[model samples]
Target chain A: MADNEFLGNVGGRTLSKPPTPGDIFFDKSFRFLTRAFTWATIFLLAFIVYKIGGKALPAFPDLGIKFLFTSVWNSSENVYGILPQIWGTIYSSFLALILGGFFGITIAIFITQDFLPYKVEFALKNIIELLAAIPSVVYGLWGIYVLVPLIRPLANFLHEYLGWIPFFSTRLSGLGLLPAVLVLSIMILPTVAAISQDAFKAIPHKTKEAAFGMGTTRWEAILRVMLPTASGGIFGALVLGFGRALGETMALAMLVGSMSTLTLSFFAPADTIAALLANTFPEANVGLETGALMYAACVLLLITLIVNIAGAVIVTKATPGGDRR
Target chain B: MSQTGLQLPQLERQPMEPRALKSIILSAITIACAITACIPLFSVLILLIYRGGKRLTLELFYTLPPGAFDAHGVGGFGNAILGTAFMVGIAGLISIPFGILAAVYLAELDPHSKISETARFCAKTMTGLPSIIAGVFAYAVVVLVMGHYSSWAGGIALSLLMIPTVMLTAEEAIKMVPNPMREAAYGMGCTPAQSLVKVILPVAMPGIITGVVLAVARAAGETAPLLFTALFSESWLSPNNPTASLAVLIYNWSSSPYENLIELAWAASLILVVLVFVLNIISRSMGGKTKL
Candidate 1:
């Protein structure tokens, strides 16, 4: 009460308050709560690992090691192979990365340039951010109705011109790996663009001007200094986009055609691990079906874990003040 | 000049300098890419609206799903709207306090400990956790244990997905609070807990709320995690019943064999997008106001 009274009165002179039993309990409990919250994350991570592993163990005895390489997915036979889905996930993710990385960087580089007016910059940034906010399912719905139909003619055109190329040789079905890749790219563009924009923006103005002062043109300055300086952050952005593409579910499920086999042509239908889980989960009878499904999910878990860890490390390292941290 | 040299120089003259061409090309690429990048954005919005707009009705929002044979996009998806709200709301209730407390622990109590670093890394990695895996975890823990799929399981999965995002952003918000505020609170003979609640937390409230809102947006948009955990129901989803969600409705209807249901799917997609976009805008503007 004295301390409370002292705090109420300004210029009360430096006064130390005696800790009361109630105050001590309150402080200890507060500490306990925060500590518990902190540990909850670590515990959650372990619990996820344990839950997936526990469920997946039932399938391990049935499928053995062949589960990774086998592509045939007959649930009745107690055979579940995720190889095709694995390949599809990796292939589409990288393809999306290339698309997202290219267009996303282009957008980032575009906005970072000094010549662009503020109005244009603001609008461009807004679009990219809005693109990020659009739900994956929304993107999926759009891809199903609009993008796939548009891709059909383009697929025919490519087949007519580049039929000999394995990547473009598959029959011209509108819904396939290519549509999924395209959608994935569009989905991740905002991620790459935003990160790179922030990284480029974080650059010191003098560093950029110094390049210009040395008789370099705008292109030369950007290429020589700005890009090189922000390369770490840019790579982090790319990886971030790749990780997103890998884990993307609803959109790719709708667009990727759900073909179960691995094929070289980009025009073929395919299933990512996520798509497979989403599409088959409802119909997956019981016992081995569910267990193997969880197993596939476990694989996705490991992959995302590594990717996200790497992204986190990269991002932390690339932060402007990471050296101090 | 000698006649031969003068003639050759005049004949070989180029229209623009190489440096000029390089700058022009670079500028063109940047502007061109920015403009072209917009194609997908415009296309997605226009197509979704064109496809989804005609199907929306007040009945779609107010009533429960008609039986499968009953026609139109109206009435059926009302359950989904409420279910998503229920699950995400419950998730927000569970996660926000825990996330903020963890963030405060990192930012104020122990900024540089190894445990804190490890916790930070775990939270970062959790951001990239595949939503499907979260579903499986919830299915195993809640759905299986409860003997059926329920909204509670769905909320738990969403909470798991949301905590990392909420925690990381909350950490950033807490750290952003000026040190002087904390010192002043302490100087007033306040305990550490009092300082945290009375001074530091108030200063950080805007940013923390923004983070929580973003987490809610993410949980609301998610489909994969809810698939196994919540499952789907065509009827009204009371707290004890199986849940319906807009994302799952969009997924199911878009792929259905029936034409009308597909139309309904588009309408549902539109509603879902609008909801997510509104939440996104709110969280963004909230952060923007804080100048963070």
Candidate 2:
């Protein structure tokens, strides 16, 4: 133990401290340790870029822009094009976003509107957040064993009756873009709703009072005033959810039929970037196959970066009192 | 105007009828959507019980997976259950210390520095990085060097996935420690380091523990990040050996073309969900407002 020494008088009393040598040693070492861990955050991002980029570089020269535009993939031929997968990612995410965003916002309104009992609202919200905690793998299992079987008949019904429409034209396998979209929508709802709920709650109480004072009904107040006021934050939340849907892997991989193709029919099976990596990285022969998978991952990373950045921008501009401002 | 006086008085006395009708429909829509949104959660639980309950047997936990042709549906998934625990335990060990320290730097040491901001931003953004990227990165770094897939690499990948969640949550916990606690420590001539370790940390322990539990739950259910890192195996797992996890096992089994494998998948799913659901309930009850 370091010897105690008189450091100061009258913090209303005399104060003792460790000797200067021990203090210096402890402070220096502690600071260095904390600094390294803190910088680990930065180092983490750089390392990801370095590792993925290093592996992806081999494919870039060989495929270039062609990689993004072509759809065929066969490891046996060492030929790969990710166009179909890209379409699958975008198409499914957009479909999921449209569904999740609409319902998520509505759910936010339902839970936050003060009509339900406090305990019920609280419990419901917790249950919804549990959706976020459920492993994607479990979700995949549920989709395959339960959701697919239940939806197969409905899909077939859609196909048989609505064959005139392109989306419903193809025979339903129950494990195609439609099921993938539904699963993603269900998966993302909590994210969208939670953040939207936060935005809705943050609107000044006085705004609600003002709307009511103007003779606006409960629905009028929520739709006309509340929705517009929180639209920026709501949009941000939706983008976040959509980004999540795109990155969703295990469930989509298991449910999306693992096919590589671009088709307008929602009944067709499809693939996404994250699902592709999850499905292929294990078996990737250490050559071009690995490079292509890494390239696909890089593309997914780029998409998330764009979405996150754009979300930040929209939220900052739209929200009344954003943190950055 | 002929009826202006009559119309004005009626408007003042009553709500707009059409508007009221429209509001009613919209309100119903909101409520309907809320119920619709909640259907998936309850349905998943109900179906899991219905299907997995029939397949649940004591042997499922004791025996290796039965092959697809087994008519009896005989074996258990003891290996996967234990493997998940071991891998996530190692991941928690790796992430917890670094996460706490990084959080301490953010909360106490230099909260406003550029590097601190970079750390905060990266941690925030990294939370959204696809789990597959973490898997690929781990494979690139650990598997490539080790010349094979291993549980060590899987744990490392899970640790990366966990660090952001742990750091941000711990930062919140530590920041919640009252300023007066630190001031009192300093009044006793304690240094910033002393105040942090002796006063702030103890005060923040509950919230930090909550964060740790949630992070563990998060890591335990992870499947994507372990794909290329842990790979998969049916046998008992060693830290340096390929191992199967409950999540991965469920994935492989559910996807198998055989009905028996699918039954095993449901049984595993039931166990995994129950474990995760319990952990999440504990975490939420501890910190009702903790960030997701």
Estimate, for each residue in A1-325, the C-alpha lDDT of model 1 and write its tens digit. 7876757765665556577889878988998899888998888898899889888998898888899999999876777799999999999999899978988988888888766689978877888888877778888888887888888888888988999999988875767998889889998899899888877887899998899788777889988899999999899888888898899998888889887889878888888999998889867887989988988988998898888778767866896975322
lDDT of 1 by residue, B1-292 (tens): 5576554434332438797678888788777777778998899888778877887777788777656577644355888999999999889888998899999898889978987888887887888888888888888899889898899999999999899889988888888888788889888877888788888888898888899988888888899888888888888877776899988888877777777788888888788778878888888788986664
Q: Kindly list the per-residue Cα lDDT of model 2 for residues B1-292, writing each as its tens digit.
A: 5875664445553445788878878888877888888888888889889888889989888788777677867777898888899889888998999899999999889998999988988887787788888898898999999998899999999998889889988898988877777889888887777778888888887788888888899888899988888988878767788988998988877868888888888889898889988988787677854332
Model 2 root mean square deviation, Cα atoms: 4.0
Model 2 lDDT at residue B82: 83
Report how far residue A152 has shifted in candidate 1, in Å. Answer: 0.6
**Candidate 2 local lDDT, A260-287, one digit each (tens):** 9788788888888888888888778878
Displacement of residue B34 (Cα, Å) in model 2 is 0.7
DockQ of each: 0.68, 0.68
**Candidate 2 TM-score versus the reference:** 0.93
The stretch of ten residues in a row with the least summed lDDT in candidate 2 chain B is B7-16
